[model samples]
Target: MGLNGFSFYNFPTAIELEYHQPLDKFEKEINEENILYGDKGRAYLKIFFDF
Candidate 1:
């Protein structure tokens, strides 16, 4: 699953937020553990300046 959002106003700046994760099952226990143990999901924030 994944999601994204952006905002733009009168200001000369823009903001973005995103999140993503695996939605499918793994074939092996090690694979599943490797994917789910540490960084199972990821998120990001970005800003843009327009001039």
Candidate 2:
């Protein structure tokens, strides 16, 4: 495969979520551990791909 053979594919929208604080009890429980990146809320990432 060469660079010329490649073409521009669909640039799917990248949705970025920001956690300001725990919105509900479930978020609070999960964020209590501090194992995640957030202190007041849980941090996460979403990837769109199906295999």
Candidate 3:
């Protein structure tokens, strides 16, 4: 999470990472899914990646 060129902080895990641009009209926007990585069918990978 950062504004400008300054970094705020890194996510504790790679799978937990997300990048969302800020906008006033985005309050109702749904987060797009990454099914290959976020779906439960491949949940084993979470352990493999130490999530």
lDDT of each: 0.60, 0.40, 0.30
Q: Each model's TM-score?
A: 0.46, 0.26, 0.16
In model 1, pairs of residues that clash are none
Task: Report the lDDT tens digits of candidate 1 across residue range 1-51.
Answer: 334445457667766677776566554367456443333667888777773
Error of 3 at 11 (Å): 19
How big is the positional error of residue 16 in model 3, measured in Å on the Cα after superposition? 1.7
Off by over 4 Å in 3: 1-14, 24-51
lDDT tens string, model 2, 1-51?
111122236654343444446554432335455333333655555444321
Segments in model 1 whose C-alpha atoms lie over 4 Å from true places: 1-11, 25-39
| Superior by lDDT: candidate 2 or candidate 3 | 2
In candidate 2, list every pair of residues with a backbone clash. Answer: none
Best by TM-score: 1
Ranked by lDDT from best down, the candidates are: 1, 2, 3
